[model samples]
Target: MRETLLLLSGFVLLSSSTNLDVLLHQSVPYSPQSASTEQAWIASLESTHTETKAQTTSTVEGERVHGSMTREMKRQYEIAAYRRTKAQARSTPTATPSPRVATLNPIFDKQDIEPEHRVIADQAFRIIPGHCQAFLKNFYVRYDNPQHRGLGGKSTIILTGSVPDEEFRALFFHELGHLTDLGCFQGTAVAGSTPYMDKDEQIWKDDPSVSFYQISWMNSQAHNRGTTEEDFVSGYASWDMFEDFAESFVYYVLHREVFARRAAENDALAAKYQWFQEHLPDLPKVAKSNTRWDGAIPWDITKLSYDWKPPTELVARR
Candidate 1:
């Protein structure tokens, strides 16, 4: 048996054997300048104005109102105006901050990752929809864990070791699948073994993924309930619903037409394809590929072609 690592708060780990991903946690609260501080500043400016006005009245009473003002009074008036200007600037609302873009931060031991590999990884990242990509923070590429191909967390992805360019792309997409499942459709947390709510703010049980899960699994543990090998995209997917979603996600991206042909033969696959079409319609499609659905499903879908619609084409689609 593979060694099981414990799940950490705000992060999830994905191993070759199982997928244990989590929802993106809430961001740190941004505390603007306190209201009381603004009020205090305003009050101080008012006090200064009152004093300046009173001095001006007393000093100018027996002389010309503007020309007889003392140097100190002029300086005070200028300071008061400056303070008023600052207060107004502070109170003015700023434009909302733009969302953070996902970045690939390689923690490799030698930093010898090939330029072509980086391009492949970038292409895979762009393949994900823009909205879904917004939820991601960092894609860490590390060489420490050679055994695990990829791992995913709330708003992060970890691609381990190195493989062929196509395999690297696929592995990244597989982990991205986990990120999309957890982050993109993240909902409220509830009390139970199924802790997350779906996109509709209901329990995780009602999630659209659950609908796909129901096609093969009676529950997470009981797999012998009516579903057959043909029903799943790959043997790994049959392991559990999380893997099912992730594996199917890769298939939908790398082999959409092949998957569509297979889906025609199997109603279960057709439904899964439909699920992707309906729920994740914005994902980029493969522009060119020679992969066919006639053979047995490959255990690793990432080992396939790397061709996909470029970011420019994807933008046009939107």
Candidate 2:
């Protein structure tokens, strides 16, 4: 009887780790919105390995501020600015209660982690290594319509545990880049410099059309250009400002010396790098040694999942 049970367990694990494509085809159908997000995520992933194709069909959602500026994106930016104000508020004794620690459900027991790898996870926005694809099975999503039920607030950093240190570092910053877009935190830092942006002026106050991303030279290959023409830190930065920030943030955080040297050559890149130094003043200079991203995660493109689904159901019943 014990042998039978052990066999059953092994089969379950094998199916999950190896049969993802089969599972996706048999699983819940993808909502258009969720599909779009999945496509964007996949594109971003592909960009790490190859030049990503332009996503002309992908639409940016928000109230139109001007040509491409949207109020929705501006609101996301406002949230980050608000977080700064809230951080300041917390400095006072009478400030509101601190936010609850971020919740995570990892397949590996935290009690089993070595001290060093655990530290790396915390610094990288509480990243938890697990089967990211299977994790999605727990949620329901409708991506195309905001009126349709879906998750809210949080974004995901999808990676398998076995990723190498360099790639893991890249993925960590990439997700943080998405978080920066939500205005959850300041997007820049310097070792000991003054705060990067105009504290008095809100970022959302400016016309979005005039932002640094509007520069004509920025494109899918922006990262490949010489420092003079490249406003982004890597090729992935060309995806969007959100991606640009994430790619740049990783470079700024992991390769501070390199970032500083390059910043000297480009005014726009310099300003972006300076934000991390000034705003996140206390961030450590480098990831701890012995950091291991060894957890394995299965991939499925069609699954409907999100980190934070709104409580209200947004879909209409037939």
Candidate 3:
């Protein structure tokens, strides 16, 4: 995602070019033009949230609220969000796309996917077509239940279902990496907080069986060229310690042989790989052909953004 920093109404808005910027621009206190827009957006969100609570809650006498109305309202909210996102995209100059027409890969719709390819997607992700768009322009997966937000056990991965099978599967594995951390394989903390920061290559420095020379040398070259932000696996991994572990986990799980070769050539990666091998002992090794996780998915999440409102047909709302 491309992040742009903006100074607006005495507030620093750090937003992804699409959803974040659209939703955030309205909240600037100094803009009268946006205040009304922001209020309407907030109202939509509140209304949906309120309805969700009403439908799910019971009175002291144990009577349920208006369930049908709640369902209807939810649908309205989804349509509203979809419309708002489109409106914002048209108005926001920065969001205009290049001349290239990116083909949207549909993950659902039985008529759309080939019979052979559609075999296990719904079984794996429990995707509900029409409830949500095939692709979320801004994010890969959204874990929405209070307990499941971000990476949590209670969370179900809400996929955009917009990419090709291989790309979608790669995203699935990446989220799986987040789930791994949520399960306790948290790799490292921020650099200043732990010795692991500078010791990625030397986590087992004193262990005679480990060799650090090759990875350390590689790290030095990377530092000189600014190719990697840290001694983690990839540039994206350098964003945060958690992401670092996730990136590494996906690589090791999917492309074991290739990752192993790379690990052997770099001590830091080897130690990280060793950590996963020990930490997630039961993690199955996948065939190289199955390792489709290569780069970040091309996210054009204009459809995923909302001026305000909860999705009406939310697949896993809580």
lDDT of 2 by residue, 196-303 (tens): 222222233232211334332343233334443255565445444444554565555555565666678777778777666664555555432222112221121112
The TM-scores, one per candidate, come to 0.59, 0.36, 0.36
Candidate 2 Cα deviation (angstroms), residue 202: 15
List candidate 3 segments past 4 Å from native: 1-156, 184-230, 289-318
Between candidates 2 and 3, which one is better according to lDDT? 3
Quick one: ranking by TM-score, best first? 1, 2, 3
Candidate 2 versus truth, CA RMSD in Å, comes to: 27.5
Task: Encode model 3's per-residue lDDT on 117-199: one tens digit a residue.
Answer: 33323322322222122222222221121211122111222232444455445445555454444322222323223223221
Give residue 166's lDDT in candidate 2 (0 to 100).
48
On TM-score, the candidate that comes out on top is: 1
| Candidate 1: worst-modelled 10 consecutive residues by lDDT | 30-39
lDDT of each: 0.59, 0.36, 0.37
lDDT of 2: 0.36
What clash pairs does model 1 have?
A: none
Worst 10 residues of 3 by lDDT: 31-40
Each candidate's root-mean-square deviation in Å?
13.2, 27.5, 20.4
lDDT over C-alpha atoms for residue 16 of model 1: 27
